[model samples]
Structure formats: structure tokens, C-alpha cells
Target: MPAPNPACASNKTEPSMLADSIDALLPQTQCRKCGFNGCLPYAEAIARGEADIDRCPPGGDAGIAKLAELLGIAAKPLNPAYGIERPRLLAIIDEDACIGCTKCLPPCPTDAILGASKHMHTIIADLCTGCELCIAPCPVACIAMVPAPNLTWTETDADRARLRHLAKQQRLTKLEAEKAERLQRQKQLLSKAKSAKNQD
Candidate 1:
């Protein structure tokens, strides 16, 4: 789907500007459960009035209530299309079974999984948003999601995760740009070589 216009909101603040406030209230798991690429995109959709606050399974009913109040709309039940709300889940890697293919690393929004290729991978408990993003990519199927009863997600945690997610996005964008530049230079050199050979 085309992204909502960043300026679509009619509030005094543009949707892009209003996104910050909406994002602040989000769980910041960077999980795509809400049908957006990340929490910020979902917030932007909400700001643009394109997405409902009830779509966040991670945010649960309370989160919907908060959004409802913020938007001055009546609170509604969490939307089942996005999945039902549940307790926070933490991803655990089975060390013995972990193949260390590094496939799981890229999916983690927080970069919580740490390991080199061909080595045992481990998840940093505190950094893990329990987004369950790492589980699907594991080639060994060794990753498991378990309820995190002792850990409570808070505003501070959300803020830190948000910053990390943004940083990761920047890093990925830079890498893609560099890769494109390298490819362009390679193509130019090949073209030059082909021309030189033809002339000779």
C-alpha cells in the first residue's frame, strides 16, 4: 500500500510532526504486527488517520485506550486482525541447537542477537524487545519465545528501543547507498575496459 501522506493530518501539527507524540506512546518493539514496517510507521499512519489505534497487538487494550484518549475518540477493543494481546514474550536461542548461520541477526530490530558466522548466537535479554522477529529467521529453528514475567516494559525502555531502531535504519540506508555506488563504479570500469579492448 502507498504510504499515507506525511501531511495528511488536519491538526495544527502535520502528521509527520504529530507522529512523535503518537510514537512516544507506542511499545516500540519495531515488530511489524501492526501491518506497518515498524512502530513509528504505524504511529505515522495513526497520526494521518489512516490506521486505527486498536491494530497494535503489543500495545494491548490499554494502549488502545491511551490512543483513544489522545485522539479524543472512544476507546475500542483491540483489533483481532493484528492478533490478540498477550504477555510480553522473550526470544531464547537454544545454544546447543543454534547453527550460527547469522540469518537471525538481521531481523532483530534492536540488534539483540550477538554472534559471528559459524558461532553460537545469543540474545541480550535486556535489549530483546521480545518482538519475536529473530525466531522466524533461525535456520535451525532453535529459537523459542517464552513469557517474560519478570521483565516489565516501560517508557524508558521504549525510548531506548526507538533510538536503536532509528540508528539501525540509518545504518542500513548508508550501507545500501554505498553498495549502489560500488556497483555503479564497477559497471563504469567494465564499460571502460570493453571500450579499450574494442579500440585495440
Candidate 2:
């Protein structure tokens, strides 16, 4: 038997636990403004001391403060290079101009966009995080950002976004695991064939 991987050992300062706590404090906008793939990745980076708390503009100064307090570090100002705090916005699609190519669908972390290939896509206003992730993928440039109506981002919104983001992550993890299993099975089959050929 081999020794267990130290990284996987149970410990008081487990990276996953720290990351989870950090992730819970995030704004959950799934915006790359933090220069990360999503809030969870950013949280992991923070847990590993590889990222700073001020990089998340969606969280703003208040959010930074929360993270700093959680990590027992001094709060710093939001890094301008990342982005500035702004009013929450929602994506609006020009239905007529939309080519319905569905390029924007996968980039949406929240699955807020509703459409299929060759069909006009629309944003679910309540779920939109204004991450601007879907805009660049649109070939027709039909998407625009507009201030959310009578809706300000609150902790409740963040909680919802966190759930959606987590669900997306879980789905992706499952897909990757399935792919790896398929590859392993294929390799085993090839190895068995080679062994039989050598014995013949």
C-alpha cells in the first residue's frame, strides 16, 4: 500500500473548506472581472493564497471587506485593473437582429439565456448577472447591456447565483468524469488486445 496524497488528507485548513467559505462570500456574478473563470475558482485561488480579495468588482468594497474579515486580512480597495463597481445590469437581446447561432449559450454560467440553434435567444432578466460573458460570443452583436429595472443586487441574488454556478460546476465535473472513464476503458481494451496478440 502507498501513502495517501498529502493534499487529500483531512486537515484543519483544508483548501476545499476554505474555498467554500470564500465562495459563499462572493457576489457570485460569475464575471471574469476577477480575472478568474468564476467565483469558485477565484475562491480557490484565495484559499491557496494565490489571489487577492480586491479583484472582484462585483463584490465591490463591501464584499472585499467581508472576504478580508473572513481571511483575517486587511481589506484593500478594489483593483481598478479588474473593474469598478457599477449598477447591476442585465443583457438585452435584439430579437430581430439575433441570428440564433447559439454561440452565446455555453458561455452563460447561469443558463440565463433561453434559445436554441436557429432560434432567437432571450435573457432571463432575474437570472442575468451582467457578466458580459455572452456578448463576445455573439456573431451578430445583437446583445446589449441595460440597467436592471427596479432590481438591485442583494445577498439573495448572490445566493441564487451561487446555487446556479454550483450546479453548472457539478454538471461539468460529471461530464469530465464520464469522459475520463470512457478513455480509461478504451485504454484497457487496447492493452488487453495487445496482450492477447503477444501471447498468440
Candidate 2 per-residue lDDT over residues 24-95, each given as its tens digit? 999899998988899989888877766778889888999999987777667889989898998888899999
TM-score of 1: 0.92
Model 2: per-residue Cα lDDT at residue 39: 93
lDDT score of residue 90 within candidate 2: 87
User: Candidates' lDDT values, in order?
Assistant: 0.86, 0.86
TM-score of each model, paired residue for residue: 0.92, 0.81
* The best candidate in terms of TM-score: 1
Q: Specify the poorest-scoring 10-residue window by lDDT in model 2.
A: 1-10
* Steric clash pairs (candidate 1): none
